[model samples]
Target chain A: MTEAAGTAGPAGSAGAAGVDGPGRPGPRRGRVLEGLRAYGLIAAMWIRSTMAYRTSFVLMTVANFAMTVLDFVAILLMFSQVDALGGWSLAEVAFLYGVSGVSFGLADLAVGSMERLGRRVRDGTLDTLLVRPVPVLAQMAADRFALRRLGRVTQGVLVLVYALVLLDVDWTVAKVLLMPVMLLSGAGIFCAVFVAAAAFQFVAQDASEVANAFTYGGTTMLQYPPTVFAQDLVRGATFVVPLAFVNWLPAGYVLDRPFPLALPEWVAFTPPLVAVACCALAGLAWRAGLRSYRSTGS
Target chain B: MTDGDGAAAGGAAFIELDGVEKVFDVRRKTGFLKRERREVRAVDGLSFTVARGEMVGYIGPNGAGKSTTIKMLTGILTPSGGRLRVAGIDPSRERTRLAHRIGVVFGQRTTLWWDLPLIDSYRLMHRMYRIPDARYRENLDRCVELLQLAELLEVPVRQLSLGQRMRGDIAAALLHDPDVLYLDEPTIGLDVVSKAKVRGFLRDVNAERGTTVLLTTHDLQDIEQLCSRVMVIDHGRLMYDGPLAGLHEVGESERTLVVDLERELPPVEAPAPARVVRVEGPRQWLAFPASASAAGLVAAIAARYPLVDLSVREPDIEAVIAKMYAERASA
Candidate 1:
């Protein structure tokens, strides 16, 4: 192409220079970088999209923030009356709740596009994405980002900090460093569940709401001990869906409390594993779904 | 083994097919038996190809595999029986790789971010294509200037005029500077000026970049103005494949001549071999063969009545294509 050969200076020179590099993996690296750049570009577009309807966005976001805070206040009032249920204090319950909240908020940011994106796939609008040189997943991620969700994440951070101050927990350098790890892992776990719920859309005609169990249900379940439920169904859902690892299991470490199960102490330290395993499974499900993509009409 | 050498379904040739088929399973109910699956052959054993750098006008009434063929060529769809390849890579196999080299525009849609400004989409394309910063700026400047997108760049795409949006879509397709471009009705809903501008842009993109372009549209003017070769498809079959000149060559030459007479003419036939088309008031229109017999038809009309004025017109592409389709219909 003339443009490829036409550019001068650094960006062009770097590309040409890499053509004869000593080893391989160069082209793919370029694509990966392109993917990241594409995502950033669309995110900016999303911000502009929000800016277009500034008043509606601001009003709706404020309402959402108010509702989130209201829910937390309701939990606090209920706990004040009962003192403690399922062996968790008000502070401990809040800690688990905050972790789950923040994780789901981050997950919503990363993969929220998937929910409505399935419609694009069904309507054949995804043809625009499939023809691009970038990875479909990257294209899908950048396809459409809803910026108003930031309101929920802000609420999550507020509750998380409150729980940390109210609880009696020993904080160390390693634990502080691992805080980001826990957040990312928790996000990964929830994102996987959301994506899997979206994948069912490939087969279903309507928007698949099954992901609510893992996303909404999972978040609510993690706020307390998994064993608190009388039926094993809730416990099974937590382990199978790995809500325990992302929130409940991690809460055990932060609270330094014994779990209902007689498993070893180290077993409670498994947030990263559960998060990663759920993510890997979801990713595989996504690829399979693409193979079965039946683009409608032309 | 061939359309002469045996045509494969959709693999061996540049655009091949071997019983290339598609069956869509539509499920209306919830249970297993409630699901009803039916086979719709959008492209039933359809097969054809345009060699490198060839400009082919793929035509069909509608849903006769025109888009299906393009989609298969672009690797968006995998044929039930055949394989597809473009630029030496199986489109389905190297879909991501092929994307870098091919450009496509959907006539009824815009590939751009819906709510973003035109320039923003261009900037994102610069990133997606990894255009060097300098080159990005240079190409951006050129396309904006060429497409008259400067004023339109600041406005959001949702707020763009239809003509303006078509220009933006075309500019976006060429941003990466692809080797192949697919246009599905690129000029469907544009004004004459916008359509001409789009056609002109496509012609230059082909000539300047030697980009092999495959376009489908209902506008015959597009074919007349841009494409040197036209391929017509009807009912999922290649009805005609040749040059535009060939389409105009209808086995015999015909020209139309109109004359106004000062007085009514007596009953008279054409002097030599011309045939009278119609007569209204003082004017008479005649169809004459290309054998230089218009003078004879005129002299005969003049002999019967005093002539006021006369002129001859060459057959336009619209009439030529209509006649061609009609002849094909009866034959």
Candidate 2:
């Protein structure tokens, strides 16, 4: 029965269908472009869906902006009472806060919906993503693509501009260049933390809270100088989780302040390296998580 | 392609599985802070080859490995053992590549974005699959017309009925012109009209486009109407594989011959092995092997007894499958 049908089947139509034959190597650049296009398409669809309810979208964005502003206000209140925090002037600390806040906000904007990975895993939505021609991480990252989170990023940028005007610094060509690099690498580090933490959901299925502690908590800790925290805690953050590269170590260099742990100034220039290493490790964790995914029974 | 066994043999087997197994490590909490780990072989030593364009029914009891096999075929889950391929691509290894050629729909889940209009989902799929504009338009038009999705295009998926949502999903799967479609219970919760519509559309797709379909459904009529060949799986093993009629014979099933006799007189003398199993008033029912010829038995009954009317009822595929599972359990 199969042979009779096979004689009149998809062999001729396969070409007409425009599917690349098995193992046919399409141009690598073309494949990457296709993946990016798919990601952008999904992200746009989600943004449109969010905009469908205009009132709610506006209210949510405003509420997010208001809520994040309070975080910086608390820092302001702290400086009003004490002349400085951990022996750093209010401007220097504000610089660190702005750096951490902007990077975390950007990371949150990009991958915040990944916090729902555990729920997706439990509900089998992850399976739907796996069958798509696009990369799974790209799909997950763009799953809901919340635009409301941009409010936090906006707040961070405003605070950062405020600190840049307030601080008196000797800016070299390298220091000037390091400013954007620090923010981007800091965001990259936080993005990797989000992905790696969410990957654990494939096994535990309800560990989103555990992931939030690292992502949100790391940003909160980075806002204040590491000098305020105990030495051992600072060491763990630096060597283990590498949250220090996010802003603390680099901000010290930018402010020309002494290192908290009396570490070398050279260590302050390593955010990019740390970000790359964290991302590579996160990539492996995500791959391993996908391979270990036992999709829920139908 | 390096595993060149069947790829060289005319490429007949578009979907092939050889001793494919999926063993899940299920952990159970036996007590407080105590857990036990056990291996549950969802698919055990299963082997089957589906030639291109074959709309085969893959029926099995719940938790009998139907979904697991589909997951493995789609590369959602890797097989613990054995070789499996779809269109000569190792699914788990080149899942994204193979995904360009295969479309899958899970009845219990909607791949369409819930808050978006039905057409929006199709539009997203157009870019996601990188489908050619002309071909996407053609396939979309065909599916819309056949599945009666024109009215539901603008409606949000959350607002559509279950049947309407199901049609939308089927159309979404086809817009890319996939070479194969895996439908897990496509007719699951649909009304009679919707089921018929889906079955007709699938038949046309297979006949016209020659899209190989592996449908797993509980609705036996789905197989009766759409598939010429059916496979019955139980306990991760293929118990039966042949024409739907042959399934009854494998189960040793019997077809009932209900006869309305002229004032039932002592259970009309039926032929050997076709004895009356029940007699009520003037109606008498006889049991005959489903594989037997009912014409000869009907003739003998009419010749001797005053038979007013008679009808031969084909064995129920559902019952035949249940008996197949029962027999396997006992053996």
Candidate 3:
């Protein structure tokens, strides 16, 4: 192997980059761009691989679409018994559900591979990721991009459009701009939650259902108006987990509805801040998780 | 005995470890409510060095910290205590940086994407490692040719046979032209042909490319055929580190001399301590200590018996190591 290394060394030195020199820091911007490009290539490969099985891909997408639609149907059935619940109309509830759905779906598509980290760790495959130069999170995400989540995304968009058409809200530029912000930041929050769930595997040796209680259960709870829940539960979700920022708070501004619990109107626009905070916390948790994993490697 | 240029220039081993140790804290459930905690020292104060371009074999029985040492070398697991360096870089502190210089293959599980074609995994690695296009192409072409992977490149990794997949994995590890390659059981579960192919490629890559190799294997033949230097590890300790021939003497193994007598005869009266261990018609087998000179016994046998032909057999590595282990246990 050293003969190849000896020959390859001169070839590598002859190249423009001059091979990983110590303390050279080789163009930070270029490295970031290269990392992004590598991630893109990996993502493309994953898409191609998933596309290899067209029938399964389509079936999974359809199955995902049908499964989420049943939740919407259940909500509709509940509305059939009463004109409105929690002082919000059916369209208003759809608005909340739609936003949460779209954001969660997009986040699921982006970083859902975090859910499989526990399995990978258990099977000793995570060692492969650590060997790579790129960040393990990026590798895991790029390894499995869930295009099937488009099912939930499409349903969210359709429901959101229907709600916008049905409700006559005072459409303002600020409110319109906030829609994407809400969706993206909500997605950011969900992505952070997914990352946190993955980080737990390093601590617990396997992904725990406690993370699901916050992610899946939290998303299910977010689809409804916070007004319907007990004040304490609402407060906990607002302060403890901040799921309110993902849907409840933003829905108030989007629907031109009064803030629940007589909270300040400014709370309706704090999803981006909450999302950023969640991401920061998740990053810290992930780093600690990686440290523990390296030390113990359970 | 020929030191490669890298070791000559640097005047140091490419890999170095001093008093390395790895301890694991494990808790076991003894009963429904009882739990016990214990510290398992997987690697204990072990030390060895491999010069640049040296193909050294690391051999040990299961649970003897072979895999753990490899993991620590690759920075997948941090050592609990010791001084270690690969190419002057601390692996755990600068793992990603070190990744550019080192390549590793774990024979039991693949690093390649199982659902993707073999080439797809290589392509991803090309990007991931930031290999220059020309270099990537050159290395990929070389490995594909040498490993006979042209037909297997398009096959999904999951569909490849174990041997084919192992070959593909070896190629993948070398495609980046890493300075040092760590192979943990690279030929595990491989058939004879596949194993031979892998060994041949490994030899070429080491000799022609001057790439340093640290191979861990259970197959004694792997060590005998490829490694000029071999390290024997047991119970997380370096039991022996020397040439393959030295191991025979250390284990007190025996060399076999099969003598073909001119006719069917009683077991020839052999020299003391060189008595015949087996007899069949006209042939007799003599077992003598491997460290003893074969000339004295052969001359004595020839002077007394009508010997038509005789051949001396070197001690078997398997028996030597097994005896070594038994001796260690008894000691």
Instruction: List, for all models, the DockQ compared with the true complex.
Output: 0.26, 0.30, 0.32
Off by over 4 Å in 3: A1-35, B1-11, B257-269, B275-286, B293-313
List the lowest-lDDT window of 10 residues for candidate 3 chain A. A1-10
Which lDDT tens digits does candidate 1 get at residues B294-320? 776777777867779999976565566
Best by DockQ: 3
Better of 2 and 3 by DockQ: 3
Error of 2 at B168 (Å): 1.5
Question: What are the per-residue Cα lDDT tens digits for candidate 1 across A13-53?
Answer: 23233132123233545545655676777777777878888
TM-score of chain A of each: 0.83, 0.88, 0.87
TM-score of chain B of each: 0.79, 0.93, 0.88
RMSD of each: 6.6, 5.4, 5.5
At residue A79, candidate 1 shows an lDDT of: 89
> Model 2, residue B95: what's the lDDT?
68
- Displacement of residue B157 (Cα, Å) in model 2 is 2.0
* Candidate achieving higher DockQ, 1 or 2: 2
